[model samples]
Target: MASTSKVALITGGAAGIGYAVAAMLATKGWLVNIVDIDQEKGVVAASIGATFYKADVRDYHSLRNAFDDTMKRHSRLDFVFANAGITDPRNFYEAQTSTLPPEPSLALLDINLKGAVTCTYLAQYYFRLCKQGSQLADFDPTLVIMSSIAGLEVYSPIPLYTAAKHGLVAFARAIATPFKESDGIRVSCICPGPVFTEKRKPSDADRLDMVPMETVCNVVSELISPGGGFGRCLRVLSTGISDV
Candidate 1:
């Protein structure tokens, strides 16, 4: 909790890419706040020297409370990682047996696209406050949105997931310019191809050209750097990163 240390709030930081980023930041002496629905992972966050708050990203109030608590404790916010998201559980195009068509599950959309939007709003509000209180001229706050390769291309297996990811890419690009000009907030999207995370099985690694989590984390680190450009969509592959 040094006065000069930066603070970062990450959604779904209990596991996967979010957890990776949280650990990296904590190691770099950042005051990291992890907001997630998994209470049991609180110990995991502590193990990495990060504070964990149990909350669902889909619940706006709960998520906002997490943000409020972070500001209350740290008195400043520098970065926000809107990384909470889930893949579609079932095929959305599958035929239903009922007389009338059943409603397809929107849980993925709610958590991925809608959750990121909520995080963006809160980040902007808090970032403005940070800028108002700071004296430095280069206080560049950043918000990194997590997207997928499905966002840029057609992933035929899960149409709903693809749609949700596409929305995230579009949303991040749409607000990057205004946010930078008005609040000095750097907004960017990271769309990685077939990442090897907790959600993926061991056998699938043999078939998929999966991108390493470390590579993705490196890209995130670069995007949040003070010199990072705004409104850029980076596509990470097994080989390297490129502009979308």
Candidate 2:
């Protein structure tokens, strides 16, 4: 075990923003358990000194098993990042036939909004367990949700993705105070503008407005710190981060 006993569980941690955060925390000696649907990334996680659990965020039971296994192994959890999400797969407005429009796929909502809600519920439950077992007078557990700039504004191209992110911000704000009072758990949402990740090539023209992966990871570090505030949606841009 590391000198610090702090532990974090992150979804979608195999790559992108989630992976960056996990790697950052691992370097800081925080025990990181990554729960991602991509099983192939398990080795990548291990390379960073983080454990990886193969589980889909949309599957409640499988996700819960990851949580259970993490707690069983580490016996403590200080942070949980609900970062799994995806963009709208098909056109919501497009009509396959002249008379009737094809049913819009809601997979985005299931993975983004619903998955986040489930993670939040499980986080609170385990946070309480950690509280009961801890000897420290002030044990604070934090939940950091991944929202997007689209959540704050209209993103016409991906309406479903925008809606899911918006729900995350609202959900975090709605439960922050209550969760803090009830479980001594702080909750906050990170709303970043388009982020530069492996999937996003630098050659793309839109890269100008994209936030760096480092910036997003740094924000996660701040949010999990002892003094990290609750209920605020911090927006990350190419330049810096600010409260939204």
Candidate 3:
């Protein structure tokens, strides 16, 4: 409703880089909506002047309902940050097999790969809708997806993570050329090496690579900031990795 400020919706905005992005956007004078499945994270995001919506990125119905409610409450949607993801460091070959040989849990693939695809599709739909919709002439929807450095250089031991991240990088790049010139919606992705989060731990072997969560925040802030993209996956290297 304010003249200069805008509205931003961040998926996975409850913690880690998501929260950091929310904080940065809020400071930049954006009305932020932090979407995540974690209720606790939602509460935290709400505490920081952001509205919270609990939705699993993999579920279309959930996301749709959340977005519907968000738009109704806010009256407009301007930007989207699809940063929710899961990380499973297990190599594809290293996964344990049962005597029955059950289907793999594939939690990493579901949350990381499929989730990003789903989010982008939905976000793109809304971006186009805003362009066409009469009530939202001000809508210039921007999308910022979160990928990783592993997306560029294949990580030997973490094959699935790399596959998912690499998929994201390609997905975003595939759209960048056409969307930037045609749609007027800017799309960019940030591929951070390793941010210090409770979910991630760099061992003796992986100890040589990583970055701080704050540094990652800075990168995410730059991605959807009305500018274009950095084509390759962003890599936060060794010195940053050493601290983690």
Candidate 4:
């Protein structure tokens, strides 16, 4: 069926929080574009009104093409959830003693921090285009950045990850206030606690202490409503930081 609704482009929409957001938004009548590097997962997401895109988050040209392709295919883009991220923890303190495979390169930083920022700026470009282009159906655009609680506080043990998350949170806030600079774009960030899932297990500590993914989903869903949460900071934590 031809969709007559606005579209949401979700980076990393093939799994994790990105997938969760894509699913909910699709059911809500938004034509979702799931952007991920995983071809298999991308194919699966295409079955659910989400057009899966294979693009590396760190590459600017790759994402530019992806974003351009989305606009050509969807005709209008309403929201962009910068959700692509790397879930790795081998950095900073282990390179000196490592004798294995070039030591997990600074790829995580490139993908998680730099990638998110670039994707966001790309989204902003489209949002501005929508705001000005008369051919666009959805005049107002939104950006839902997937930051983590680690950004708000020093919760995670991995320094690199925590630093990146902190950067994401600060980026969101910095754009939102005096927010007029963003061409009326509603930029918001969601800081989720350790969400329970099966694709992988959390750290040993995370096993005994975690919250349901649904809890986080509910918050994002609410943020979509008219006058829903935006332009301000909110936190979702099972505890203050150390749940032990």
For this target, which candidate reaches the highest lDDT against the unseen true structure? 1
**C-alpha RMSD (angstroms) for model 1:** 1.6
Indicate whether candidate 1 or candidate 4 has the larger lDDT.
Answer: 1
Q: How many residue pairs clash per model?
A: 0, 0, 1, 0
Task: Show pairs that collide, candidate 4.
Answer: none
Question: What order do candidates take by TM-score, descending?
Answer: 1, 2, 4, 3
Global CA lDDT of candidate 3, please? 0.74
Candidate 1, residues 1-244, lDDT tens digits: the string is 3247889999999999999999999999999999999999888899998989999989989999999988888878989999999878897677789999877678888999999999999999988877785775546799999999998999888998899999999999999999989888999999999888877898867755888888999999999887789898999999789988
What would the TM-scores of all predictions be?
0.95, 0.94, 0.83, 0.85
Considering TM-score, which of the candidate structures 3 and 4 is the better prediction for this target? 4
Q: What is the C-alpha lDDT of each candidate?
A: 0.90, 0.88, 0.74, 0.75
Evaluated with TM-score, which candidate comes out highest? 1
Candidate 4 residue-wise lDDT at 214:
71
Residue range with the least summed lDDT across 10 consecutive positions in model 1? 131-140
In model 1, the number of clashes is 0
lDDT tens readout by residue for model 3, 1-244? 4224578888898988888878888888888988899987667876789988889988888887777777667666778887888877555676465677657668887888888788777777666665664355455667877888888778878888888898988888888767768767777777676667656654633565556677776666665554534343455554642111
Off by over 4 Å in 1: 136-138, 205-208
- Candidate 1, lDDT over the whole model: 0.90
Q: Model 2 Cα RMSD, Å?
A: 2.0
Instruction: Assess candidate 1 and give its TM-score to the true structure.
Output: 0.95
